[model samples]
Target: MDTTMSADTVVLLTGGTSGIGRVAAERLAATGATVVAVGRDRERGRAVAEEATAESAGTVAFRRVDLADRSAVRDLAAAVDDEYGRLDALVHNAGLASATRRETADGVESTFAVNHLAPYLLTHDLIGALADTPGARVVVTASSVHRRGSLDFDDLGFSSGYDALDAYARSKLANVAFTLELAERLRASDRADGVVANCVHPGFVPSTGLYRDVSRRAKLLTRLAGLVPGVGTSAAKAARRLVEVTAAPEYGERTGLYVGGDGPEEPSEAARDPETRDRLWRVSADLVGVDPDWP
Candidate 1:
């Protein structure tokens, strides 16, 4: 895959301060793309940008964004458009693994808000900028765990009962569903030729910051799992797949594809359900206060 980027190519990446996101940001920057790395921590964001810029041939800029807040996500989209005018690629790599259920300021489940709704809202807000840019791509960091997920629309926030793994898996499933629907929407729009959307499972990288909120026992188990062959991968290795899916010329025209370690793989039955995808899109749009049938 050709890793070089045009001088005008601009990529916006979330959760870029650590894990695969961080590694991918630096790698993309090294390929000469202008990378806007978004995160909630100001200091860590700045440090990641500085380190990536110092080591890469391209430019990396830090943008503070709290994915849990819908309003903040909207502001981020506007800022990106105002600053760059065009977004070549938008990589939704931010994720959360909560040990216990919590609610966001928006009165939504924290895991769902951060993992799924954030990307959904941000992409919706940036649709115009993305459509305006040629060969624009949307890359979401999903998970293989989505296969075990079951989405309960009536209790999306898990008001009745909540399990950390269940919540996380459901959110990952939402990511895949969202991408499938987004691809269809973009394809039906006038700018179909320019914009595309896809999601990927970056492989289980237990060493990443994603497990910080989990229990110590869970963390130890993940570490042990990582040591086993074919169980987990390093953040750096997983990040290469992210870059390939997000920026490589091979995947430029592909939309709604679920990429695993090797290449495009079939997603779970739930994720591939058209009705579920449409319902999730509508519900997500309503929650974020955007038109459900947006271009």
Candidate 2:
């Protein structure tokens, strides 16, 4: 870990209203980093940021954003650029676990839109600002459940059929693919030297609102899983791994890396598949109207 605090470094975190993002925002803010938290609920988002800033004795602020809207994400990026002049880190932590299939106003599936496309679009729009700062980091929160997800590009929007679990898993898988591919693309470009990208699985953190959409019985089962000696852990514990990944000195040279619970474990077979990663990058760029030139 760097163990060095710098107030000048700014971290923009999504889904800062609750759960892991909430804890992370506070911790980063406390470390003298300026934290700009993004969430849909204005009250909750502001409260979280305020609490974080209060606890850290550092700078923390909130911005209301429904990431599912592409234009909103663009505006948010513009606002960040204007306010901060540079974005040092971006944590794509916002996510949703919907019980039923729903579509956003943009005609994209809600799960895919919120979980994958929003972050993809946001990161792309802010890449210039991040590259402007040397030694900047991009940390994406992924999930171990990505192992179960097989990308079906033709039905990416869950158009033909949709299962909540499958859709969620696919979105998480997209996160991994996006992170890895982004790392590859950025590493080869002028941005490679300073702006590094990485992704992580925070482990099966229980009571993280990740199971809020599941049935009561399912929630009970998840609670039970965490209780099983060494199972689903606390969000605080999970956040440590994520925080360390972003701030650690050891990772300074390793970009496009997929990290697991115990340091840098190997990602799933699917996550490491170069072909799948490339294809997902193309499809995601097509969906978001960004150039697939990075591929």
Candidate 3:
């Protein structure tokens, strides 16, 4: 990667135990940025950081965090603030794709809590540091599956009829909407002048552990898709794009854009709904116990 940040640039990435987050962490570290990876598995997290640190001229570390627990997530955010004192980027990449419905420690659905609320709390807490970084960026890893989503705030937990794929899609859709609204607020408040908050669909990359719970039938389908040349991209390639977008000056001062494999794409109808996005921001603030002010 040609892009290089200052030696002091601090990047905090979740879900770096594997997949795109792992690759992105390593790539950023090689570029001379401090990388702090967050995940629940101590062994895997340590291994990832060690490999990155070995390949990097910068510092690489790991912090165990389970985003499903609200209080735990809050504490992790506080720890990050205390340790780093400044955050240049936060990549919300950790997530779970469960075939069964699960609840978080805070009684919220696991998918919702991990995929959305976790980043919400973490980013909310780290806004001060992000704002301090002149060219800070927030990149959310959403998916094309989000196109198949519908927002039913009344049934946010999917109580009546819950399917794992649908729930995951809804969470991703919420990500795009959250990015849009958050970008708007950031620009309006002028807190993040050169900080651009954007979302991206990292196209299908097989063997990412996201399909760990998929049935045999799903696995077969994934294999078949991989057989096709352009159907699935590699984790490394996708992470390269992510790193580029996050570090590029072209994205500076721009916010709320939904980028795809082929560059920016039009977001889903639900994702573009300002009212719904605003409402989600408010609801997420309440869930995370943050004040109403979000920028």
Which candidate's lDDT is highest?
1
Residues 14-108 of candidate 2 have per-residue lDDT tens digits of 98788888888888887899989898888888788777777785777999999988899989999998889887788998988787889988888
Candidate 1 residue-wise lDDT, 24-47, digit = tens: 999999888899999988888899
Name model 3 segments beyond 4 Å from true.
none
Q: In each prediction, how many residue pairs overlap at the backbone (N, C-alpha, C within less than 3 A)?
A: 0, 0, 0
User: Candidate 3, residues 174-210: lDDT per residue as tens digits?
Assistant: 8888988888888887666556789888879986888
- Which candidate has the top score in TM-score? 1
Pairs that collide, model 3: none
lDDT of 1 at 238: 93
Scored against the true structure, residue 244 in model 3 reaches a CA lDDT of: 73
Superposed Cα deviation of residue 52, candidate 1 (Å): 1.2
Ranking of predictions according to TM-score: 1, 3, 2
Report the number of backbone clashes for model 3: 0
Q: TM-scores for all candidates?
A: 0.98, 0.95, 0.96
Q: Ranking by lDDT, best first?
A: 1, 3, 2
